[model samples]
Target: MRTKVAIIGAGPSGLLLGQLLHTFGVDNIILERQTPDYVLGRIRAGLLEEGTVSLLDQVGAGARLHQEGLVHHGVELAFGGARHRIDMHAATGKTVTIYGQTEVTLDLMNARKAAGLTSVYSASDVKPHDFDTDHPRVTYVKDGVSHEIACDFIAGCDGFHGVSRASVPASAITSYERVYPFGWLGILSETPPVSPELIYNNHERGFALCTMRSSHRSRYYVQCPLDDHVDQWSDDRFWDELKRRLDQKAADELVTGPSIEKSIAPLRSFVAEPMRFGRMFLAGDASHIVPPTGAKGLNLAASDVHYLSQALREYYDEKSSAGLDGYSARALARVWKAVRFSWWMTSMLHKFPDEGEFAARIQIAELDYLVSSKAASTSLSENYVGLPF
Candidate 1:
């Protein structure tokens, strides 16, 4: 088989990139190791930056998002037995939408199907070959039969652990990472959210976040030891721990229900440099990962796709390699800023076991200054709402 671009992954990054490229009149095919049902079953971040929403709109996948996604203009910081609001819309004239990543993927999947785009699911041993040469190709085994695809380019949106980045020699790439000492124990419940906007809480006990997938489905999380397991946490214990970390008012208004989903996610900041390797380019998790404290993971992926899609479009439309040559440097600039923001947020909100009381006081002081100062709040707002793509 042959295509202009072979996208290795059916996650949002690859799917969005494929859609964008198709709209640009560039043909592409997607290969995934997992089935479509498995892809939709993975739970992920629900916050959408304005830039991410715009990308979906560009691909004609924003109709359902606009109909169902909740729009928030501000977020609250809880500390010192109180809650303070950061007016993101007031500060930056931008708002974030509460749309689940799964929904975004489903929307993109539906759009792609409607357009008759090619996507190979449940194809095992999928690999990109000869991406370093002028003629690149991808190979996979489907139904125990081997197949190969000759393509002009390859997109490695498979993620940090996928074959795309793994295909690059160790000497050709550099990685930076910081694995945090804690993890978030989160749960989803069929109940109204405690607040209209998301609340990020910093407590002496640990950090907690109250976010939602929709008006009626609340998603909440509390910091825990890195080694903690989901089996150790029951619905009652989770809710009690969450209440202890929240302000009195939020605790009073909090509605608890049987958790439909529960999991513990370790926090980490990871980045692999030089996103481009010859004819193959990496986008999204394949290139970078951020702690979820700032809600930047999926948005970062979208930004990578934004830069990548543009670069690919320019390559085909204007017959220029300038954009392709600059894709890595351009994407990395934004990737690092988000990494910094996510690290900052994790530092400010999470309790480090070794840091002790001084660090706690410092965090309180930082949060106080952040909410009290207009400049600091604006800086947070701008980063949270997302920087321009």
Candidate 2:
């Protein structure tokens, strides 16, 4: 098979890249190891910053997004049973939308399908070959038959394990990573959100977040000890712990329902230097990862694809590879910014016995300082709300 670009992984990044190329009158084939249903069903990041929403709109992929998304203007910070609101819109003049990553994937998949595009699924033998040559090839199995896909360029949007990144020479990619001490235990409940706005609570027990998936459903998370067995906790125990951490008052309204879903999300930070390797380029989880604290994983992936598509559109015509040349450095600039923010938030809210009480006090002091000062708050809010593209 042949196309202008052979994209690995049909997740958000790959799908969006195809749509972007189509707009430039460039045709591309997206290959996936998983079926469309599985790709659209993965539970992942749900927040979209202004730039993310704007990109979707420009690509004509925002119809359902704009209609079904919940635009949140602000979020609440709760401590000592007192709630403080950060006016994200008033502070940054922009708002974020709450739409799950799976929803975005589904949206892009449906849109691309309607356009008569087919993304190969259940494909085996998905591996990178001939990437050092002018023509890169993606070998895979489809419909019980082996196949070879060759293209002028390859995009690795297949997450951390995708083949695109593996094609690169090991000496060329510089990687950095840090693993945290705890994870977030999240659950989706049928009850309405306990708070109208999303709430971030730093309670004595741990950190808890209360957000909504929709009007009738809520998404909540609480920090768990690194080795805590989630299967051991009863529903009552979960609620009691959340209440203690957030300092919820008895009089406050609370939602009651069976937890429909539960899972642990390990905290970690990762970035691969020089995101581009010859004719093959890495994007999305294939290149970087940030803890869920900052809601950056999805948007970060979008940024990479956005740059990749623009480069392809320009380079295809003029034979100029300026954008491709600067791909890694340019994307890394933003990636590092998110890296710092995610690490900082994770440190500030999580417990570390090795740090001693003095260190813990300093963390609280930092939060207090941000809340009390515009300069500090702006820095936090800007990153928390979002940075300009």
Candidate 3:
């Protein structure tokens, strides 16, 4: 088979890119290592930056999102036994939509199916060949049969553990990574959130966040040791701990319920330099990873997709390689900024095992200053709502 672009992975990035290309009259096919159900079942960040929402609108996938997604002008930061609100809209003239990534994937997948875009799910041994040459091809196996797709370009949107990045030679890629000492033990429950807006808390016990997918479904997280297991935490104990760490008002309003989903995600910041290689380009988690503190993971992916989609559009329409040639530098420039913001938020809110009491006091001071200083709060709000694409 021959197409203009051969996309790897059926995740949000890959699916979103494919849809955008299809809308531009660019022929492409998506390959996934798992079933559609498996991809949709994966829970991920729900905060949608303004740019991301606009991208969905461009692809005609915003009908469900705009109807179901929550719009928030601000988020609360709880520290020193108080809850402080940062007006993101007032600070930066922007707002965020709380729509789960799973829903975004479903929207794109349904849109792709309706448009008759080809996507190969459960594709095994997916590999890109001859990307350095003018003609490139992707080979994979489906149903025990081998197949090849000859394309002008390849999009490596597969993610961190996907074959896209790993396929590149180590000498050509420079990776920078930092694994935090703690992990987030999060739970999803069918209960109302403690607050209407998301609350990011810095408490003596640990860092905790109160967020939600909707009015009735809450997602909560607390910092825990790396060795902590899900079996070690009970529903009651988790609620009790969450309440203890929150302010009096938030704690009193908190509702407890059985956890529908629970998991421990380790915090880390990772970035791979030069997202483009030959005719293949990496986007989303394939090139970088940020801690969940600032909720930048999915947003970063969207920005990368936006850049890449635009680049490919230019290449095909104007017959210009300018955008494609500049994809790496353009994407990485924004990627690094988000990496810094997430790292700063994680460092300020979470406890460090080695820092002792001095660091704890310093963290509290920083949080205090952030709430008191309009400049500092606006900076935080700007990054939270997302930097301009």
Candidate 4:
């Protein structure tokens, strides 16, 4: 089989890119190593930057998103037994949409199916070859049979562990990573959220976040040791710890319920430089990863798709290579800013293992200044809402 572009992985990035290209009359194919259900089963961050929401609108996938998504004009930061709110909308004139990543994937998948686009799922050993040459090809085994796709370009949307980035020689890619000592122990509950807007809290014990997918469904998280397991945390224990971290008023009003889903996620900041390798380019988790503190993972991916899709469109529409040639620099410029913001937020909220009392005091000082100073809050709000694409 042959197409203009071959997209690896069927996650949001791949599907979004495929949908955008198809909408513009660019022929493309998507390949996935897992079944559709497995892909949608993975839970992820839900906060949507303005850029991501707009991109969804452009691709005709915003009907469900705009209808169901909850818009928040501000987020609260709780520290020192007091609650302070960051005016994200007043500071930046932009708000974030509270929509689950799962819903986004479902919408994209449904849109793809309705548009009659092709995607190969449950394919094994999917690999990209000859990306550096004028002609690129992708090969995979499906149902015990081998197949190949010859295309003009390949999109490495397969994610961090996928074959896309691994296909590039190590010498050609420079990587930077930082693995934190703790992870986020999170749960999804069926009860109403403790707060209308999301809350980022710093307590003497650890960091906790109060966020929700909708008015009735809530998602919450607390910092935990890296070795902590789900079995060790019962529903009551999780709720108790969450309340302890929140302010007294919220804690008093907090509603507890059985957890529908529970898991722990490690925090890390990773970036692989030069996202482009000849005809193949990396987007989303394939190239960079940020701790969920600032909720940049999927947003960064959307920004990447923003650049990659535009570049690919220009390549086909105008027969120009300038956009494609500049994809790496443009994407990385924005990626690094998010990296800094996520890192900063993580530092301010999380308790580092090696951080002595002095470091903790300084963290408190920083948070105090951040909430007290208008300029500082504005900076935080702008970064939180998202930098321009």
* Most lDDT-accurate candidate: 1
lDDT of 1 by residue, 1-389 (tens): 99999999999999999999999999999999999999999999999999999999999999999999999999999999999999999999999999999999999999999999999999999989988899999999999999999999999999888999999999999999999999999999999999999999999899999999999999999999999999999999999999999999999999999999999999999999899999999999998989999999999999999998999899999999999999999999999999999999999998999998999999999999999999999999999999999
Compared with the true structure, model 2 gives a TM-score of 0.96
Cα lDDT over the full model 4: 0.95
Per-residue CA lDDT of model 2 for 146-193, tens digit only, reads 899878988889999777777778898889999888889988889988
Compared with the true structure, what per-residue lDDT tens digits does model 3 show for residues 1-389?
Answer: 99999999999999999989988889999999999999999989999999999999999999999999999999998898998999999999999999999999999999999999899999999999988889999999999999999999999999999998998999999999999999999999999877879999998899999999998999999999999999999989899999999999999989999999999999999999989999999999999999999999999999999999999999999999999999999999999999999999999999888788999999999999998999999999999999999
| Per-model TM values vs. the true structure | 0.99, 0.96, 0.99, 0.99
lDDT of 4 by residue, 270-293 (tens): 999999999999999999999999
Ranking of models by lDDT: 1, 4, 3, 2
Overall local distance difference test of candidate 2: 0.82
Backbone clash pairs for candidate 1 read none
Model 4, 183: alpha-carbon shift in Å? 0.2
- The residue ranges of model 1 lying beyond 4 angstroms of the native Cα positions read none
lDDT of 3: 0.94
Predictions: Cα RMSD each: 0.5, 1.5, 0.7, 0.7
lDDT of 3 at 64: 97
Candidate 4 wrongly placed segments (more than 4 Å): none
Model 2 alpha-carbon drift over 4 Å, by segment: 249-251
